[model samples]
Target: MIDLNQSDKRQLLFDAARELFLEQGFKKTNVAAITERANVAVGTFYKYFASKEQIFYEVYQAENEKAKRKIVARIDADQSPKEVVKQFLQEIIRTSEQNAILAEWYRNTEASQVLMNYNQECDVQKNSFVYRFLLDNIERWRSSGQFRRDIDANTILALFNVLVLLDNHKEEIGHEHFPQVLELLAEMIIDGLTASS
Candidate 1:
């Protein structure tokens, strides 16, 4: 049921929107700017996207999807859960920094909220790349008696979810050394999780 021509137009709009978002950023970019950049009628944008926020979310998602795959591919099959989680935390920061729109998701903005909502949805389903990647790793470790059997997977999942919550509170937590803080926090959590081993 896919219309090739319409799909092409939609992609044009999306490509244009992503460029504008990366260049001017979310606050400065508008629908008309996107449509003009895409070389399409303003009305055409409506047919493809509900609003600028929707397109921004899609743009951000594209970046995140790439990051997710990259993170998974970077995983070492022989690594322990602690190392896996540690490397994942580091790689996620690196990838986020590499993508301007993805980095924007860490900021306090409407777009960030949308991105968080996307994460929350994926969390509930337990199907997101990172969630599934970590979940499977945790379960494997738990079964191998490497991770603490006393601690359920959901509790550990909640523990990792703290990272996202902390990102939202960097200003309150002091942004001066937030990266160090995150590194320290990850070490503490990973050590605690692997204390049994």
Candidate 2:
């Protein structure tokens, strides 16, 4: 099912590009550097990607896939929906911190434009996976009168957007306050979706 040669070459480019991007940055790193680092001919690089932007796009895609995998693994452990949600936020924050290139990319580059375009072209499911996962798992709570029946599953997706904003403001809140901040936001969301006791 997998094209070994194509996959290996693509990964070679991605790994090399990611290293260079991390070291010198996107604007500073040229295709020649990437090709040399990848031990591939310049033509070989072009065979897999149209431009440096395209290569970075693949790199970011792989990063997102890794993030999703981490999220899935962190959530799969036995935990309450609320606990899982907390860990999910923690995982994202941890991942972003671990991937300094991602933070730097978000801060210095209008890289979101390329990322958005890539998502539009490839991710038909978009943000639905996260939203649906939360909604399905939380439904039992709703049935047990622990959550509000009126809250839409999409509301959880919207909450994810807020979490992103909060995570991005790590300095303002500081890492020491992350758990409280996340819990507060989660509580606010839960309150909005649950009947008042």
Candidate 3:
């Protein structure tokens, strides 16, 4: 029942939305602008996405996939578990800042919370890049004795989740002190997760 031409039109809209979001951000972008840029009829966008938010969510996912590939490729197998954990935390901040859509979510706490709540409701954490990355590497680290044998990947995930929570509250925690706090916590998490030499 799907028209072959439908995909091309949808992709055009998707690409145009991404370009516009990156250039002017979510608040400034309009659905009309997206359709204009995509060279599609204004009504055609409604056939693909319910709203600007829906299209932005699609763009966000695509951008995250790109980031995950880069992050996975950059991680060295030779690094110890501690360094890997630190790098993982650092990459969270780096990738978010690098992507405009991702940064917008952080800047708007209510929107960020809504997105996080939706993820929780859908139980998508298992399919997330960070979860899968930690799960895969945790297994390898445990086998190679780089990580504590008794500790499960979930513990590490919880720690990382806490770090994310702290980062979200950085404004209340004092922007000037957040870096020091994050550094201390990362060190503690690394020390906790690593096996003794």
Per-candidate alpha-carbon RMSD to the true structure: 3.1, 4.7, 3.3
In candidate 3, clashing pairs total 0
Please give the distance, in angstroms, between residue 21's alpha carbon in candidate 1 and its true position after superposition: 1.6
Q: Candidate 3 — what's its lDDT?
A: 0.77
Evaluated against the true structure, the overall lDDT of model 1 is 0.80
Mark the regions of model 2 whose C-alpha exceeds 4 Å error after superposition.
Answer: 1-5, 76-80, 120-132, 158-184
Candidate 1, 184: how far from true, in Å? 1.8
Q: What is the per-residue lDDT of model 1 for residues 132-172, given as tens digits with 9 covering 90 to 100?
A: 77788778888888878899999987888787689877777
Residue range 1-197, candidate 2, lDDT tens digits:
53459889987888999999778766788899998998888998888889988887777666766676768766863565567777776676667666845654345435655655665687535554555566566766666766666765566556656865564565568667876787789867866766554
Clashing pairs in 1: none
TM-score of model 3 (CA atoms): 0.82
| Stronger candidate by lDDT (1 vs 2) | 1
Tell me the whole-model lDDT of each prediction, alpha carbons only: 0.80, 0.70, 0.77
- For 1-197, candidate 3 gives per-residue lDDT tens digits of 44449889999999999999899988789999999999878999999998887787778777877887788778875788777766766776678878887777667665465456555556666667767877788788878887777777678677767876785677688766776688689788778777474
Residue-level error in angstroms, candidate 1, position 188: 1.6
Estimated TM-score per prediction? 0.86, 0.69, 0.82
Ranking of predictions according to TM-score: 1, 3, 2
